[model samples]
Target: MISFLRKIRQKLLSQNRVTQYLAYAIGEIFLVVIGILIALQINTWNQQRIENNEELEILLGLKDEFENNLEELNFSITINTKVTEACVQLTQLIRSNSIANDSDLLDDLLVRIGTFNSFDAQTGVSSEIVNSGKLTLLKNDALRTRIINWLTLLIDQEEDILFRSDNYTMNMMPFLMKHFPLANGELTKKLPFDKKKYLQNYQEKSPFKFNIAKEEYLEFENQIWHHKHNNDYVSINELNLKDFLKITLQMIEEELNKKK
Candidate 1:
């Protein structure tokens, strides 16, 4: 192409038709400019295509990560709800004075903890996402924002669990211990700490805190263990715990729904 242009330039200089030469020079200049522009446009197009592909891949990866996260969050919520139910039931049983001795109540309380352990199982959504190194792969800004918000809320819930666990245990446990019986053999697990231990170890800011409400209910939980010490037999408060369990299940549902 350069050779062709050179030949044209040579012709324009030698030809007698100088007006025609000027027109031809202008046309050649326009053609060269257009070619450059075309090349630049093609380069831009290729770059944009690559970027779009990368963005799409990120979106898909983010979708998968969030979906799994959502499921786990929902599961945690289910467990929390069940634990809550245990609290409510234990409260009713204790407040209603349904048990003649504290031993049966203690068993119910222990069982409640067992239920809590099952429901309040440890979860690692943030860890999983962070470890997966997939958050870096997220391309959609909107999706990323949503994920961040969801994670923030989960953190808040965890914080709430930390906040309420201590004092609730301190305030409630000693009160339950007065009625709790012991050495009945009907209850299996022993109440390791007496009521005062709650206040002694009470912490609103402990990094080691479990759900305070969980332990709060556990203070009365020893009542069943007490009854077991005395050879009395009875059912724990399983039915009453269901309402909290139901709440937990709802949380799971809400977490799942968040993905949509």
Candidate 2:
């Protein structure tokens, strides 16, 4: 093509026809410019296609990760709800001075009060997308904003979980240890050994014999109230996180459908 165009230009120059040669030169320049623009447009299209594919893959991965996170978060909420209920019941029993009437119920509530579940989210895909600067590949403005906000939500949720965990470890456990027999919590029922035999052994070998009758209920009730408050906070956060995950997942699904 280059050789053909050069030969034509040479012939036009040799003819000594200035007007025709200038017109031909202008036409050739226009064609060359058009060719260059077409080439650039094709290159841009190819680049965009590659980026769209990459974005699709990331969205699929995020869908799976967030789904898993949502399931785990629901379970944590359920467990925390039970713990909060236990706290409420224990408080009521203590206030009514009827806790000693039901030793079994007291033991069960004690175990429940000390139990907790943390929302351990799966953030591998989202973290990589944000940290590696691939979040921009996501073309949807709403989706991008939601993802950025999701990270912040996790931070808030973690703080609530940490507070609940610390309460269980530092406040509830110590108070229970001082005022109640750990073995009476029915934990031995889950052990490999026979429950009766384990309880007997625990009773015989235990250094501290806690008599609930002699223990003050007011201090224990205060601890229960504090732990319950922490549980309530965590539960609220988990609910909000669950809603965020659901919305994000819906957006991801919409994006995936667009790709298809």
Candidate 3:
């Protein structure tokens, strides 16, 4: 192609057609420029297609992670509700002078005391995307903003859970162990209890005998207060998780549809 154009230019020059040769040269340059632009456009299209596929994979991974997170949040919410209810019942009994000789109630209350959910969401893929500067590939401005907000809230939730866990493990449990006997403390640290045997024998074999004292009841009241405080935080985080998960899932669906 270059040789043919050069020959044409030489022939035009030999004929001394200066005006015609200049016009022909300009047209040839324009065609070359157009070809380069077309090649560049094709390259840009291919690169965009690769990026789109990668974004879809990231979005699908996020969907799976958040779905699992939703399940965990639901479970935590249920446990928090149960713990809150148990704390309320115990507090009411103490306030009403109805706690005397309520060994059965005490046993039940103890069982519900430290059953906290300490779950962490799977954010490996999301974190990698954000930290590696791939977040811009999301394309949708709204979705990007939502994802950032969700990650921020997740950090907040994790901090709250840590605070609650510290309260339960360091303050609450130590107080309980000091005052009352727990038969299954060792068993609980490892795995699920052998339910039938545990329920039947826990009270009898407990190191500290059943004793209802004013000081013990007061300590339990303090424990209940801490539990209630943590319960409220759990409820707040559960709602946050639900809302974030719902919005992200919708955005993911939209992106998937666009991909198809």
Candidate 4:
């Protein structure tokens, strides 16, 4: 093709039809420019196609990750609710000075309050996308924004969980250890391996049993009250994260559908 074009240019110049030659030269230049532009346009379209496919894959991955996270979040919420309820029941019993009647129930409530629950989100897809600067590949502005917000919410939720954990570890556990036998609470827990059997094997029984005095009940109640509020904060944050996950998943679904 180059040789043919060169031959045409040589023939034009040999004829010395200067006006015609100049016109042919201009036309040839215009065709070369047009060809280059067409090639560039084709390359642009190919690049866009590759990006669209990549974005679709990212959306699919995000959908799966967020769905799993939603399930885990719901489980955490349920556990948090149980913890809150246990706190409330214990508070009622302490306030009424009726806790002395049911040692077993008190033990069960104590076990529940002592158990810690936190939402463990699957952040693999989202974190990689954000950290690797691939979030922008998600062309939908709203979806991109939601994904960023989801990461922010995850951080906020983690902070709330840490606060709750600190309260449980620092305030509640110390108080309980001082006043009550931890084995009593452990007996209430249902583990895969029989905890009661394990304790019996070890011949471990606290000689000092849990005996809450009327005056001490107020102090214990204060601990439960604060722990209840901590649980509440965690629950609220989990709920918000759940909402964000649902919205993000829905947006991902929409984007995936567009591909179909």
* Overall lDDT per candidate, in order of appearance: 0.47, 0.84, 0.78, 0.84
Off by over 4 Å in 3: 184-204
Give one digit per residue, the lDDT tens place, for model 1 in 200-250: 322232132122244444555554333322211111222222332344334
Which runs in model 1 stand beyond 4 Å of their true positions?
A: 100-105, 111-144, 165-260
Ranking of all candidate structures by their lDDT, best first: 4, 2, 3, 1
Clashes of 1: 32
Clash counts for the predictions, in order: 32, 0, 0, 0
Task: After superposing candidate 4 on the true structure, give the runs of residues whose Cα lies further than 4 Å from its correct spot.
Answer: 191-207
- Per-residue lDDT tens digits of candidate 2, residues 1-260? 99998998889889888888899999999999999999999999999999999999999999999999998889888888888898899899898887768766787788777667788898899999999999999999999999989988989888888888887888788878877777766543332223365443233323545565535676778889999998899999899889889989999999999988
Model 2 TM-score is 0.89
Please tell me which model should have the higher TM-score, number 2 or number 3.
Answer: 2
Between 1 and 3, whose TM-score is larger?
3
lDDT of 1 at 86: 57
Per-model C-alpha RMSD: 12.7, 4.2, 3.4, 2.9
Q: Per-candidate TM vs. native? A: 0.55, 0.89, 0.87, 0.91
